[model samples]
Target: MSDLLIGGAETSTLAALASPVTVIDSTTSCQDVDELFRADEHLGCLAVHGDGPGRSLGLVSRVPFQHLMSGRLGYGKLLNTRRPVSALTDWSPLVVHAATGVAEVARQVLDRGSSQRFSEVLVADPGAPLRQVSVTDVFRALSGELATKALTDALTGLANRDHFLQRLQQCCTAPDVRRRLALVYVDLDGFKAFNDGHGHGVGDLVLQVVADRLRGCFHPGDLVARLGGDEFAAVVQLPAGVPVGPAARQLGERVRACLSGTISLSSIVLPGRASVGVAVASSVLADGETLLREADLAMYRAKAAGGGRVELVTDVGSTAPREQFAPDRRELQRAVDEGEFLVHYQPIVEVGTGRLASVEALVRWQHPRRGLLAPGAFLGAVADAGFAANLDLHVLEVALAQFSRWQRNLGRAAPRAVNVNVSVQGLLHPRLAPAVLDALSRAGLDPAVLRVELPEAATTTQLDVVRGALGTLRAAGVRLTLDDLGAGASSLHHLTRLTLDGVKIDRRFIAGLLDDERDAAVVVMLLELAHSTGIAVTAEGVETRPQLEALQEMARGRPTFVQGHLISRPVAAEEIALPWSGGLHHLHAHVPGPRSAVPTAPGPVASS
Candidate 1:
């Protein structure tokens, strides 16, 4: 909050005051001067000069510069940390002409320092063009009142969101800020659960505990801030000699153990834990935002990997990256434009009969560079960035068209049934049934021949939407299958309310069905429930001989179905083949028009 000063008559204040400066166009190398600053034992300061002859642009301090050089800034440690001294000098030593009042100079100082990485202000006289007028050092000139008002978080007495953002931006924009940085985004696990179980009083206590734990984790030079609610962020400049990764790992582990460990209050133990997403940017990250994103993503990964554990933020270039959700949205549009996405089909065969009852339509990405990637590689990206609905619609259209062709070839008696897995959006969308019915009618395909599958875990809070959609689908003769049922709680309510055509037991529950007693018992119970409801059961992920045998035993004297790698893996659309002969098991001919899209390599179905 110090008055941003410039030598000019008047200037508007910048968003942030303390930021690093990089000379995008400088004649002198700051490297030699930077080394000098690092080696200095007292009054550590860096004087930056602009590109023009005999011109000083701005100055930087030793502490912030040290933070940048040591990799303690934003994602500074992950990617390239150093920039040409010329770049630093080009923007540094900001010049403001004299005749500028203290208020005007303050505003200019604020505006310039808001983005650049400099803690001090340089005033120049207008009459002398770049001559010095006065110096307003950051810590020395800024009053305590202004500092308190600008930096402190009103709720937690830590750094506020704006201050954190500005500081992080500087670390990201600063030259060599990426040399080393350990950025962490922390969220208290089950904090909401506390509110649900013990009311707001307990929730507030939980927040306080989290705040205290975070405060205890840093040094005097480190920054700890409450971004809001139960979320907090931290930026620590690690010691030059210390390795960034190990130190960060230690801190993350401590955070996990300390937060999750039981806390006793008035003899009532609160089972509190936290999920921390950590990203080391010193060597891999490019900016503060990227660093924060990586940490947030890693934290989510940690939570997904089962909370109370730490995960390193790797897979920078893979689908796991945050940008995975927002890749050139243009690229997605381009993919659709170029028809780079292709439909593949996997047969959903009956277990004992080994006969194909239907095929599951799956999407494959024909990425120009990545070769062929599965939906897992890019579907989440599309879905998360608000494109799933369109993509799902496209898949449905393609699937219906393919089924129409397949049914025509199979003659009048052939089953037109095609199973297409819909995303959560499609399942929950109010227009889903109408959309599917319209596709079926347009294709002249039987609605009964189309089975729609939805992932159980993806269901949203609007259970009624799914119920209504599924009800409409059922009434229209389009079969509905609750996919990945055992992977999550699909709730018997959905099953009973919607009158589903069937349930596809998740691969996880059916995996190794012959051995796991618990999985086997669940499968049996599911089979009984399906039978009582007059619904068919399809066992998914059945791979081994024992698994098939177990399924057969369960289906003995009963009508049940199975789908997995043991029968066939998903394959390209054109590769899908049906037997010419009436007998189910004979594949005696070799026609090259198209191979079955099923996976040729013999691997067990994915562990559910």
Candidate 2:
């Protein structure tokens, strides 16, 4: 039996199936072991113990061991009854360490060939008792759990971004494929606002509803996936000889119509709309990223051109070259060197007393030809040019200097902290911690006076690297926050691992908080989560009195802060007005209701 077993040395001892094994002492006779196997018909194998307690000498299987002892051969009839069970034990049975990976165990099992494929494997430490595992259990768990996690979105139950890209790649690389493929990038226009207004509980339902609508808009063969947040993508095969442009346009129109109607959850009726961008595979060799980018660019164009519309990448009148939209690399570098960038500060006030708490530092580009442009217009270009870190450092330095100036003027009346947006690139930079500490030192400011805001979307990838850098920043006494929580692919999973000072709820939820039950519930949940963890919570985009009043009510017993136009818009450093400074109090007195007070200009600040 020992000689018949193969690859025993290579099998992982840890890979034993988590199942019960029948154990018998090595002193037990073959006939006794046979009787024990007969008593438990479902038992696949038994462990034969050696002289020491809990020490397994080897394993014996029901089938082969029984055949050897049945006296089928002349030798078996004469000697089987008296032979020790150890004679039938598989001494070289497949053994693996407990720490071995499942994949390696499966590979070793398959390598043993079909004869031992279903045989029980021993999972144990050397000199320890053996535990049995089933090969079928390993494959079933791997195929069921790993496969689902890899291919499906856990939230919406649709194909995930990874699965969608893989299928798109397959379609692009299919040999001699003649049919064209269309990629439609759909972004819900006001989803963030909807989520903010209603709450995450209802927001999740909205996403499911959108997913169902999207799934209905296309044929069963088409692939649809939520690319995080309000973004969704679909890849469909176009009929032979059908022009990509017309097919994409027609499909986008159908999707728009399908998603345009109102969705009713409980007693609340929420309106829905999406901006769709269509890109077709120009050739069978086209890359997935390029195709997706083209579609994304078109989606932006649709959004910029007053949203709720579909735009095709191939549309001559609507589509512009990608380079044209992105700022010139030299121009961006010149802006940094020439001091062409400016920082604007927006006040975050306590919901209870409306007292000034902190001001978030937002960046604006003073583009020579483009006038005073928000970061959105050119920050993407800066990021694409690999200057995101440099730009982030510049903003931080300026914000710290300005914060110092504010402290000089206000003395003890200054806001508690000034928040500067930190890009993921900046956080990961080797010099980030040193640079920040130096800035604070030069300004003679405490690390607690300056809070760094990191976008939630940015921290999802390369977490170890992000966490390492963040850990250094935290160690330096610098305050850190996850900005725009619940806006993109925000998850509570991040909150569990990273050390954070606070979380800023994105304005989208605030926009609907007053009238939306879902928004109210989500806000309360976030406040509870933050408060329970000893992390502060700030709500952004509080543009109305009703929203402000409602947030105040929700945050009655908690330490919550609010920021938006209703408090004050982002203004130049010199224009920052705190409640103690008479600026905030004056504005609050004049604004009677929502949309009643008009600001001189729209807020130019953008999230980092």
Candidate 3:
């Protein structure tokens, strides 16, 4: 290990540092292993591996181990001696392979969110026992190789693209931005032409010169980077209290001048110019990629209008590029990690006696800058991002967990079950059934208390997918319902082909069910279809007393449920307990009135 460290951390591979380590049985008691740490002060932690079936690995750090055993006033050593090591093991360690470059491993180790930055790392080598590597050893070698290899541009002596992006995320993510964060994107307008015309030597020199000028353009608090080739970017902090647009433009102009100014290459002067684009975030409600993209788009616009000028984008979301506004899978993944997604519940009540039927779970994205966003704003984007399956599972877990909480509090009074929507992609995901069942098992909740809703006409063409995913769920005593009944596909075909516990009359028909004959006809037909099929019916988007009265009049003694602004809009989990116990309470979310606070850039946004 010392030889590998001395040889050079960058060039050495992780395989070289791999050392055989003892693996503790996961079922071993803490008291039995207490003497292991006391006997060896140098032992940082021990690896614990479970037996067959659900064979999993974990790490028990000396600190947490000792703390747990010590107890208050140190009595836990005797009382908690028999506790299994698996109970206290950290299961989610960042695993790596032996063939991985030490530099890469170090970067992965240190690049995690600070809370998890120092989690355990196990080097898995084929034909060998899983060996553990101390994080302290990784940190010791960080100084020698990390600065030049991972962060700094070797040729230009500036922050590299990765480092620049990290800094930009930091600026955009700051809880309070003081409304002074901005991004500057610089593209050397004719550098490629000049580089191709000249040799590689001249091209390299030009890049170094551009890097130097960029350095001069940004200050001590700013981050400037060579985003590969001729493109460079900066995350700048403007002087507080000044207008962001003006200040950003002023800085952009300086960068333009600095790059286009004096460039004498071996007594031959070259026109070193750049198209500079500036985007200013007036508030903390900004996304790193969105801001960078805004600046990049502005730069392109400047280049299109003829080079060597600065383009500024002041209005963030409205005037910024439209592509960034759309939902992105990567953005959704980040939102899940950052916990920007939250669940809201709307009461579904029986129309006859106003008895609490169930609560449908609605997913909302709570943006740091925007109060809350409905499914209309980003669900399509999530689906487009190909994250529909993952997001659906995440939402299912959240809704199920919330239902468990309610069941804990209200006992019998809690809504009978939680109805959660599952997208078509999620319904097709192989892991859906097992994951849902596992969650229910872990929560000690009955599968009957969880109702998974599938869009009615969504999978008509793919009955195989429907059968494969829904079959296991149905067999487990889980209720399956069809949402937006007449919204898509063939309603009658679905009623006959699919085994549904209930069907939601599409919101479109209910919106004007009383006044529109065609809509009334559609609702009546849907009710007849569901009733004849022995499935319950839910009238969605029921807003007024007239609509409710009209629907109740049409009911032919079948189990009918209604949900919409009429009974109450969706509310937070804690606030939902009221409607559960009260049976017919109209719940509402007190939020600032309707406003489209679309992110100018993608930052923290929605989930399922």
TM-score of each: 0.48, 0.55, 0.45
Worst window of 10 by summed lDDT in candidate 3: 1-10
lDDT of 3 at 53: 53
**Tens-digit lDDT string for candidate 3 (200-266):** 7888888888777776666756777888888988877778777777788788988998988767899
Clashing pairs in 3: none
Instruction: Give, for candidate 1, the lowest lDDT window spanning 10 residues.
Output: 1-10
Task: Please give, for residues 392-442, the per-residue lDDT of candidate 1 as tens digits.
Answer: 877788888877876777775443368888877666776888888898899
Order of all candidates by TM-score, from best down to worst?
2, 1, 3
- Could you tell me the TM-score of candidate 3? 0.45
Task: Write down the TM-score for model 2.
Answer: 0.55
Question: What lDDT would each prediction earn against the true structure?
Answer: 0.61, 0.71, 0.71
Write model 2 residue lDDT over 245-363, tens digit each, in one string.
Answer: 78778988998899999999999888778899988765533346667888899899999998899998653222332224465667677888898888877777787766678888888
Tell me the spans in candidate 3 whose CA falls farther than 4 Å from its real position. 1-320, 326-328, 369-371, 577-608
Query: What's the C-alpha lDDT at position 183 in model 2?
Result: 81
RMSD of each: 28.1, 16.2, 22.4
Which 10 successive residues of model 2 have the least lDDT summed?
1-10
Off by over 4 Å in 1: 1-325, 328-330, 412-416, 458-460, 580-608
